[model samples]
Target: MNDLRIYIHIPFCKQRCSYCDFVTYDDKSYLMHSYFKALDTEIALNRQYIEKSNITSVFFGGGTPSYPDAKFIKAALNKFDLAEDAEVTIEANPGTVDFEKLSIYREAGINRISFGVQSFENDMLIIMGRIHDRSMAIRNIKDAKKAGFDNISIDLMHGYPLQTEEGFRNSLSSVVDLGVTHVSCYSLKVGEDTPLQSMLDKGLLPEIDDEKDRNMYKAAQGYLQANGYIQYEIANFARPGFQCRHNIGYWVLDEYLGFGAGAHSYYNGRRFSNITVLGEYIRSLNELKLPEDYSETIDMEESIKEFMILGLRMTDGISINVFSQKFNRGLYSVYGNEIKDCIDSGLLISNGEKIKLTQNGLDFANKVFRKFI
Candidate 1:
């Protein structure tokens, strides 16, 4: 059986950011007890999948996995039949983690810590409605190291409404200075009906600069690599062997089981998700029913398209031999025209048995991906 990965959602965020649309709650912390009970029930109910495959990685993602009592996280993690050297990780908010909580997490088997330190600029943190300042973020990294957590990562964002190109570059520089093992840098998207979007519409905030966003992204690619980090994926950079295994399992379309409300799963070509509403999620589990809300069996053509689109997101790109072995089809037989077009346009490079994006392709990645769709 292939390696199975697990994603445990902890939606108890202490506060919500302005440009967020993730299914998490700041006001619903009062329901934490019931939610964890539901999560436990959901995990127990997936015994068949859990037993068959060796769980290689477990990711505790969140509103803030570090915000909740550490005991809750430990209890939930203990349910997994994990491999001995499993790369277990927890996503944390800098202001939410401390030495005590981190110790509990390490004791419970977590080996990696990923902090959500969006920016080094204090004013940008405030604009994004984040609680932690630059100092707190730096302190959290130091404290995690003190807690004996060596494999650490941090999340960063670019393209805020008033963000300058230099500011984003500085954030990247700070990460290199902090000496964390991994970095995931994402461009901010102001969702419709989100507070940030509302502010833009009302002229309360300036618009995000597209040129600056692109420049910042390109800068990180150069700067991080110069500092000895490798760009494994479009948004992720890491020291060699420090890449996020849980996410790589995702990009490769490997089987994964997700627990907790609003969680999604992909296994055996089937994609499914749990009920997103907190109240309803808890109620279903209480009634001894699975909280699965929706599912779909991916068709062959859709699968091929996804394989190409997602594979291209990684810096290593897609492998020809693996694709052929899995699909039993020649690479050029299906998407030869698309591949040739991308290569001709200076957007992709077909080197030996691997196909990947070119330097310019990083700027117009969506265009290359759109060809497959």
Candidate 2:
């Protein structure tokens, strides 16, 4: 069986965050009945994409996958030929779900829970326009534990407006105290057209300083490392074997099928994305058609460049042996000059067969990535 991963996008949220620009809604509760029907259709239609493949992971990312209830999720559970021990994950928002809801999800086959706990500071949560406060997030964590969730992750954001180093430390410490299996720490990027961007444009928000962001990132790495978590990916830290396999599949450039509005998929060297509108997605799927709004078949050269960039995102880096075996070309011959440039500038280090980013290289990773482009 071909190895593949599955992603289901649940685009409904109780309320949208200020910095979020993802396709999602707050008034879609009434549409849940129809939404599940559409999901059922989409699942059946896309079964061919993962045909003869043992689905290794199933991820429910969102707005908040747990918002519509576990019944909505259970409706589509049996549609795919998932592996017996598939790693099924769902993102939950605090104050929107409780131990009862989490138990229902566990019964419905979700084994991992990622809570969107941006910070442990109530004031910071309010400034970020989050619907739930720090106490609510803590409550949800405790509830998930009571509900028998062992693989729980927390989504943390740093470098928010007016956020200090001490505040970031406190946030990380809280998660460490709770003994979360995984933690994804990301800096606040005010995406275009987001409410946070608008506030910044109007001088109502302070700019997130780059130095502060870097400091917090480094601090998180140190804190998590001390707490027995490994920084396996750029922004993700995990305890032992608890790294998010679903996301790891993406970084490793493995084939995966995506369903629902605004979800993107990559299979057979082609990339496709569904329409961002929920109604449009359902309408298209209702017509027995895939809701692919845009797609691209990556060319050879572009594929090689992408392979290098994506592989470098992981701490294990890229293996020269694997590159040669897969592409039948010497790694040094293909991008010898680029590799030499990066190594000479202390952005990349090579240990004969494998290459990885240095500490300084990680700080300026974007610049290094651009070199391949």
Candidate topping lDDT: 1
Superposed by TM-score, candidate 1 places the C-alpha of residue 235 at a distance from the truth, in angstroms, of 0.7
Model 2, 262-316: lDDT tens per residue?
9899988899999988888889888988888999998778878988888888788
Root-mean-square deviation of every model: 0.9, 1.2
lDDT of 1 by residue, 1-373 (tens): 6689999989888899999889899999999999999999898888888988899999999879999899999999889878989999999998998888888888899999999999999999999999899999999899999988999999999989899888988898899999999999899987778899899999999888898888889988999999999999989999999999989888888888999989999988899999989999999999989999999999888888889998899999999998999789988898899999999999999987999998898789999999999
Candidate 2's TM-score reads 0.97
lDDT of each: 0.91, 0.88
Backbone clash numbers for all candidates listed: 0, 0
In terms of lDDT, model 1 sits at 0.91
Error of 2 at 5 (Å): 0.4
For all predicted structures, in order, the TM-scores are 0.98, 0.97
